[model samples]
Target chain A: MSKAWTFGENMNTDEIIPGRYNITIDPLELAKNVFCEVKPEYVKNAQPGDVIVGGQNFGCGSSREHAPIAIKGSLAKCVIAASFARIFFRNAVNIGLPILECPEAAVGISEGDDVEVNLSTGEIINRTNGRRYQANPLPDFVLKIADAGGIVNFLKMHDIQEVLA
Target chain B: MGTLIEEIFSRRAGGTVQAGEIVLLDVDYIMSHDNTTPLAIKAFREIGKPILDKNKIVLHLDHAYPAPNILAAENHRKILDFVKEQQLPHLFQQGVCHQVMLEEGFVTPGSIIIGADSHSNTYGAMGAFGTGLGSTEIGVAWVTGKCWFKVPETIRVELSGHTQPGVYAKDVMIHIAGLLGMDGGTYRSVEFGGEYIDNLPMHERIIFPNMSTEIGAKCGLIAADDVTIAYLENETPAKGPFERIVPANPRYERVLEIDVSLLAPQVACHPDVDNVKPLMAVEGLEVHEVYIGTCTNARYEDLEIVANILKGRKVNPLTRVIVTPASARIYKKALKNGLIEILIDAGCIVTGAGCGACIGRHGGILAPGERALTTMNRNFVGRMGSPLSEIYLASPATAAATALTGRITDPRGCL
Candidate 1:
């Protein structure tokens, strides 16, 4: 169970991690500024096991990986949204940030609610509200990549690079 | 049975691929710039492996060039050292990554390409499956020479009819953005077809695909034909062999038909790319700056139009006009054709052939409360400097005309 931070739709990349802080590639440094422009209290108030609930089209702009890295670096467990921009979905997978698409969770989960997401079974349980929702299940390959803590780790353990190359 | 994008994926996967199916395809080229290279390097090191093939990778030092400060300078140094240590041969210190990739002939037809920058879709002008990926995925591609992709549903767009004088490809693209909405093409592939596409030159073909990212498209494709072959012959010393693929009884998720003749010089207003209107709708708005350059509209054909408009007339006394070519090659061609001289004689400030002023990192940062009409894509707030500053996206011809009046003006009469 993790607390929830609710946000509106069309939250662009610039609002997630502003371009001004893009000078450094460090994830921890980027973590200090997540949602700096839109939600000033986010960096300070967010906890390690918290969850983010957003409406449609979350992370819509830019192909920057900094957005997901910042969220992961902050130790957030996962992000549950109604829908995600295509690039944001791929970027999250590359960086090993779990994301679940559950429209019910997006609408039903309130701020400070204890939300738990089960990626394999596509289940979302809101302990605070005593409600449950079904999330879209991820494909086997996508789950494999995320469970391995990103593609880099998967490649390292399986020697898939040479096999694929 | 399949669309152009589906067929391309099927050929690469060695079997039939449908929309929503995931497939791993070999990448022909991987491109990155100064801003993204540092992160990719970090990821590549975390993987603890060598790049699959150094020859297929290209690096450019265009963004924040000459170092806005010590931080940027140090990052450039780190990238240079990594390139030297890895013995990578292709590095361009003078051009934007997209332009450099095309000039070096890394983006031929019927190949899969990826870059760290979003404008990588520009390569799809040659019928290639080119798109942008994040730095981490780029790092994965660097090490494995492969990336997984979901076969995106295809939206077939049939372009027809001709534009009046002064109405350029930029106007058509902006109009389409208005029709499709900013996120209409999200998670989809867009392909151009019909007779109007046949009449467009390579310079114009680049814009449709280059601006496809504005609509969140995975890739934008135009099938190869004789025009593509002729363009290759003129641009590169050698051409890669390519056989055009046409799907038999093709199926598209949806089809959109556009007539350029119906378009007036279009402009995307402040804060959004899809907040579009006719040029005349916002004609009287005063402008403080006029910028002409970017991967979208900095081609020789675009500059030729600008030079013709500003050949003898000077820019408005209140407005500042800045011109930057997209690449060193285009700059040299413009110089040889006396376009640069005409621009300078008309009081335009000519800059280097890099992405100057486009990214707001260097060269021209708009002051607070300033308004600019530019030929670049993306006019989001705080995109070019202070959030108070505003940007209007338009064609080079419209930009040039606006420069002469210090206001958003149509290019028809000025030309």
Candidate 2:
């Protein structure tokens, strides 16, 4: 079971990880400062496999992949948002951070609510309320990349030329 | 017929690609700056591959250049080593990546360029299909010389009427951002058109695309026309057989018509780029600092506007003013034109050319409870310094006027 940490719409990358700390790219190091400005206690209280639930355009602003990297490093299982900015979605995929688009789950989930998710089946269960929601399942190619622990590992197994062709 | 993005992607994909289809396309240029290049280098090493084509990769040591801290210095050293090891020929240490990219002639119409920074959309001003990506994707592009893209649905914004004096492109863009909330253009392409855009010079046209990201746009574009061709032929080093690509019969998901005939000078308030209000609403608000620089407005013409306002006036004693030109070339041009002298004479601290203070890595940073008025884009929390500090976004004219008054003053009154 994972606890949901809810946030409002248009939660930007600068809120996730401030630009001042972008000099270091280490995921763990970046994790320490995740939500440091917006939610000062997030890094301290967040547990492994916790979930982040947000309204529209989550992870908006800037192309800093550090935002997703920090969230992944924080041991958050996945981020469920009503929508995501274009660059953030791609960055999450590149880093193997699971994300789902489910307006129902994003709006229904409450802070500290225990939840369960199934990436392959797109099933999201709110254990606290006994509600089940369906998220838009990721594409097959994206699922393949996530399964291999991101594109780098996927590329290690497949030929780049073949993939491009 | 397809939209502008569809046309660009179809040509790159060598097929009839639609908005929703994901396709792998060859990228012409891949750019990374100091803030991201270090991370991309690490990812590239993890891939254990040689750079597929070193010439296609561009590196800039602009963000936090000269190293604000030990970690940043170390990151710069790592990037320098990687550039040398790869024998990369396009490494630049002098200017913001976006400005240098255009000045060096890497941006051409109908070309696809991806950078590891959000404002890569600035290249779209010249009619290129440019967008930002993460470091890992940039690293992968370095290895394969290609990247996948989900062709975005286009939003057509048509601007009409004449822009009044003191109403610049920055004001027009801020007004647009207010009309459309932060997510108005999420994951979509925004194409600016109509008489207003048609009349803007290349420098002014660049702001729309550069600020499109503020509204969550994947890219902001304007079709290449004679003005674009003229700029490329005369201004840039591009010896391009440039292609003028306009949609023959374009389809748009939504169309918005905006009239800027009497648009007022606008400001995007603290903690949100979309919380825009006219200068009358926020006028006389005291500011601790005023910054005039960024990819959005630090071009030569923008400096001239500020210099005209500050030519014989002194900056208010209570406020600190910092001016950073977008590029070294722009800095030289401003110096040659005596704009730097006017700015310096008015008591503004002229800093080196780069993404100075805009990213809060170096240069002027606001303290807690302080407020700043800047010409840069993005006023998200903690963007320019303390999270408790406030940032107001406006044009260089507004910045100059506010700097002179130590408060948010209307540029028209000063003019």
Candidate 3:
């Protein structure tokens, strides 16, 4: 079980990882600055396996893969938002960051709640309030990519030319 | 029944493809810029394969041009080393990748192109399936010459009537973005129809797809017509013939129609592209700076319009105005036409052809609590320097008028 970090809607990429710190593409370097501006105490308070919850339209700006890399590197287990911007959604999948779309979990879960996620079932159980929420399940193809730790690793296991062809 | 996007995918797939279907497409061209190219090159190296085709790849140095600092300079050095080693055919140090791609004839009708930058959709003006992709995807494409796509549903936007004087395509796009919320067209394709689109020149046609990404559309498409043929002949005559894809009895999931004649000079208020309002509604708000450039609105005609509006007039002493030509060629043409001189005489700061101030990196960084009126798209918070500063989006006419008055004044009566 992990504590929750709640955020409001329309949280853009700049806020997640401000453009100023974007000079480096190193995931570990980027992780240090994740949510630095909007949530300065994020690094100090966030423990491993903590979850991030946001309202609608989270990660809605520049197509920076660094945003997900930073989040995943920050030791957050996964992100739960009502909805995500298209490019950000794709980036998360490409980088192996687990994200769920659950409007109920986004609004109902409070800060510091102990929540558990079941990737195969798309279930989010709120142990703090004894509430449950359902997430949109991923397609089998997408799941395989996620399970293999992202597109690059997944590609390593298959003949990209034949699989894509 | 297939939409224009579906038809393009179908043709590429050698069969009939529909919306929501995933297909692997052979990319005609793929590009990456300074900030993203290093990552793509690294990934490409990890693949341990020779590039699928060097001629099909392009590397541009526009994003961090003139390098903001020593670190940025180092990053440029790395990209240059990779390009030299790989023997990439096309490398541009002169202008934004999108503008250079079109002006140099890299884009053709019925082709599929993807770039590391999000605004790559600008190529849709030439009837190509151009869209943005992540650096890894671009890396994968560089190695394999293929990328996957889930064909998106189409939104038919039928524009009718002629544009009024001083009202430009920039205004029409801002109006549409406001109507469709910021994410309204998410994961969909926006196709243009009706008389207004038919009458638009190539520069104006580029504006629709250039800004379509702001509305969250996968890509914006306009079918090739007589104007497209004329543009290709005049701009890229050396290129050979290419097939043009037009949807046969296209089926759209939704349709939106707008009359251009009814649109007034419009502005997307601070912080949101969707918070659009008529110039009349927000007139007289003080502005500290006025910037005109970027792939969205900076072209020869754009500068010409600004020169026409600012002729014999000086910018407000308090309002600093900066004008940038989209490409070096356009800048030379504007100089030949005396537009550059006119702008300089009117107290405008003219700069080289590149993305100067749009990304908040260099040309004109705003101070906290200051405000600017610009022709660049995307005014998200801190997009142009200070997070406390605000950016107002408008057309060249509106930008010129605002520069002269030191306030958000309507451009209709100025000209």
Candidate number of the best DockQ: 2
lDDT string, candidate 3, A6-84, tens digits? 8888788877987767778888788898988678798778998999999887887676777887898899999999988
Please tell me how candidate 3 rates in CAPRI terms: medium
- After superposition, the stretches of candidate 2 with alpha carbons farther than 4 Å from their true spots are A161-165
Model 1 lDDT per residue over B1-415, tens place: 5888888888889998899887888888888888888989988999998889998888999877868888889989999999999999988987778877877777777789998888888888888888988898888888888888899998888999988888988898999888887788888998887888889988998899898888888998888888887877778754756677765577888999987877799999997889999998999899999999888888888999999999889999888899989888899999999999999999899888888888777777789999989999888676677768899999999999999999999999988
**Predicted complexes: DockQ each:** 0.53, 0.79, 0.53
Model 2, TM vs. native: 0.98
User: Candidate 3 on B1-415: residue-level lDDT in tens?
Assistant: 4788887788889999989887878899998888788778767776676788888898899877889888789889999888888777889988888999988888888789999877888888988888887787788888788888889999999999998898988999999999987788788899987899999999999988988888877889988788887787788643857666787888899999898997899999998899999999999999999999999989999999899999999999988899988888899999998999999999999999888888888889889999999999889878788888999999999999999999998888788
Writing each residue's lDDT as its tens digit, candidate 1 over A1-165 gives 588999987677777886667778888999998887667788988888899899887887777888888888888988899988888898898789999998889999988888887767878899997899999887778787788888788878876543333
Q: Is candidate 2 or candidate 3 better by TM-score?
A: 2
**Where is the poorest 10-residue window by lDDT in model 3 chain B?**
B236-245
Poorest stretch of ten by lDDT in candidate 3 chain A:
A156-165
lDDT of 2 by residue, B245-332 (tens): 8876888999999999988999999879889999999999999999999899899999999999999999999899999999999999
lDDT of 2 by residue, A77-112 (tens): 999999888899989988899999999999999999
Total clashes in model 1, counting residue pairs 3 or more apart in sequence or in different chains: 0
Give the TM-score, chain B only, in order for the candidates: 0.98, 0.99, 0.98
Docking tier of model 2: it is: medium
Ranking by TM-score: 2, 3, 1
Q: Flag the better candidate by TM-score, 1 or 2.
A: 2
